[model samples]
Target chain A: MTQLVRVQSFSVSSDGFGSGEGQSLERPFGSLDPADLHAWAFATASWVGRREPGGSRGLDDYFSRDFSNGIGAEIMGRNKFGPQRGPWQDLSWQGWWGDDPPFHTPVFVLTHHLRPSFSLTDTTFHFLDASPEEALATAKQAANGGDVRIGGGVATVREFLAAGLVDVLHIAVVPITAGRGERLWDSPDELLDRYHLEKVPSVSGVVHHLFWRD
Target chain B: MTQLVRVQSFSVSSDGFGSGEGQSLERPFGSLDPADLHAWAFATASWVGRREPGGSRGLDDYFSRDFSNGIGAEIMGRNKFGPQRGPWQDLSWQGWWGDDPPFHTPVFVLTHHLRPSFSLTDTTFHFLDASPEEALATAKQAANGGDVRIGGGVATVREFLAAGLVDVLHIAVVPITAGRGERLWDSPDELLDRYHLEKVPSVSGVVHHLFWRD
Candidate 1:
């Protein structure tokens, strides 16, 4: 079985900013609110967290539900791991997701400041100081027979994309524009040369742009 | 009846660029190809100059057909009018279009260097050195109770939008990204605070984003 690397349900603003500018401890997505970008998922019946029983069910919901299917290992950037830059000031700060976090499998956090592997719930985050190719190889190995997910923060995804490592991508475009931030692409058409794209619009105001290696 | 100021059937790339960078006699849309940005409209049955009888008829065609409906005057930037800037090197240059232009109404060309009004078929080209508000007022007067259209070249549309002079807009979102050029909005969400938006996707890979002032 082929081990695929996928970007699933990654949300970006219309201008192609996955997150906003000025990312800090308070704002993981920088100047942009994660809620604004991930509203489609949050409103879906299949989302990970639901305080109540009521939520939407449709195409948006299906993508939300399909986010973690056949994903054994995940790879992400250090910025996505936390806001602390340069040699991790606070070792006590585990991650943004506390207690029982998401991601039941092993996760490789690509960072220059390497640290000992830590566990939160079923997700064990291993700090890896390696290139995109190196990280993906490690992730694929950790995945066993399952597929690997290139979880993002903008730069991480860009690195993977630029390296031509990602196999499939499901990019969710929220109508809102962060106006400032790291952009995945100036235009989604930038990937047309390498990837076949299909844009599907959901009634919830989010356009799901699906891309696969051509 | 109220004289509405509308931005009709304006085409933009996925990343929000209406035209490409680097303008010249050869490329009207700067570095971007006008054909790439306007492929959807050109394929429509209502397009101004389609060579063949067979063209797609649906929402995309409807918007193309309604491009000039009830429009009596058009306000455009000098760049949209011609390539010659500063002093108008050649008066005989006329325009990129042949003897007959797409716009049948009186066209107001916003320029720093004003020239005498000239005619090409029914479309009279009147050069005006005026502010966006000033240009709208002149166009409104010329409209003679009919609606005035805000013809674009990025800067002109941005000017009118910034000035809060535009009423209704039917902006076409083509799937391709221009990568470089003049942008309409950093994100469509930026306008949600002022306008109600409805994104309707067509069968022919074009998403029509309709906006009306709130």
Candidate 2:
């Protein structure tokens, strides 16, 4: 079976920013508050490490539940892994998702400074310094015929999109605007020629846009 | 009766830019093509001065027909009128819209370099050098108890939105991106606190977002 490369439930501001600037230890979403960008996901019952039991079981919940449906391996940017830039300061910094991360499959972390493979729970983190095609090749191998998810922090998604490697991309446009941050694409129209686009608005005031390549 | 200020059938790119950079007479939408930004409206039967008779009679058609509904006057930036900057060298330049403009109502053209009022068919162009509040006051009077439409070129809409003069704003977000241009608002979140926002996705792959004040 051909492995499908997808971006599921990725959140972006109405202004097209995926994440804000000035990322640090204290601020994971940078200067912008996490609640504003992720209220829809947090309100859903399928959110990773959800605090409470009761949450909205609407369209947001449906999309959130679809996040981990069929993902064999996950590929994420260096920033999404942690805020530590350049060479890793301390090897102790595993990830923001604590000991048991959400992904039960093997996770590939794209970084210039490579590190030895490590595992926490069912998820294992492998650091690789390679191009998008090279990285995807490794990820597809690790996926074991299952789908490979392009988990993003803006730049990573853009890289894969620009390379035409992504088969399906689901962008959840939150109503909030991130004044400053890394934009997903300079113009999303560039993708119109390559893929088919569809917009689905949810009751939670969030518009879910899907781009797929047949 | 109190006058209502609205933006109807306004189309924007996925990145929030209404028009692209370096707008000119030849390139009305700058680097971007009008067909890309307004394909949805053109596909509708209600498009003004539509060359063809047959078009989609769906949601896009409904919104296109609503553009002129009870609109007594229109307030638009000089850019929306034409591309002439500084002062108008040619007095013959009426507007981008030929003989009969779409707006039959009194259209207020916001410009620093003022000119005498001119009329084309039922639509009369009135030049005004004033702030958002002052412009609205003038447009309201001309509206004659009917709603005043805020015809935009991005900067104009942002001004009215910033001044809190807009009552109902309907923005149709097309899947294409402009790449560069004047953006409507830095962040739409500013309005979230004051107004009610709703998103409706159409079959045309366009997301219609409505912001209304109660």
Q: Name the best candidate (by DockQ).
A: 2
lDDT of 1 at A159: 94
| Residue pairs in collision within model 1 | A21-A31, B21-B31
Per-candidate TM vs. native? 0.51, 0.51
Any runs in candidate 1 off by more than 4 Å, and if so which?
B1-214
State in Å the error of residue B68, model 2. 48
User: Tens digits of per-residue lDDT for model 2 on B1-214?
Assistant: 3467889889888888888888889988898788999999998755876876566544565467667766899999999999999988998889898999999989999999999999999999999999999999999999988889999888898888888888777788899877788777655565789776766778988987767765
Per-model TM-score (chain A alone): 0.97, 0.95
Per-candidate local distance difference test: 0.83, 0.82
lDDT of 1 by residue, A2-48 (tens): 57798988999998999888889898888898889999999875587
Interface RMSD after interface superposition, model 2: 11.4
Error of 1 at A24 (Å): 1.0
**How does candidate 2 fare on TM-score?**
0.51
Off by over 4 Å in 2: B1-214
lDDT of 1 by residue, B112-174 (tens): 897789999999999998988888899999988888999998888889989999877888899
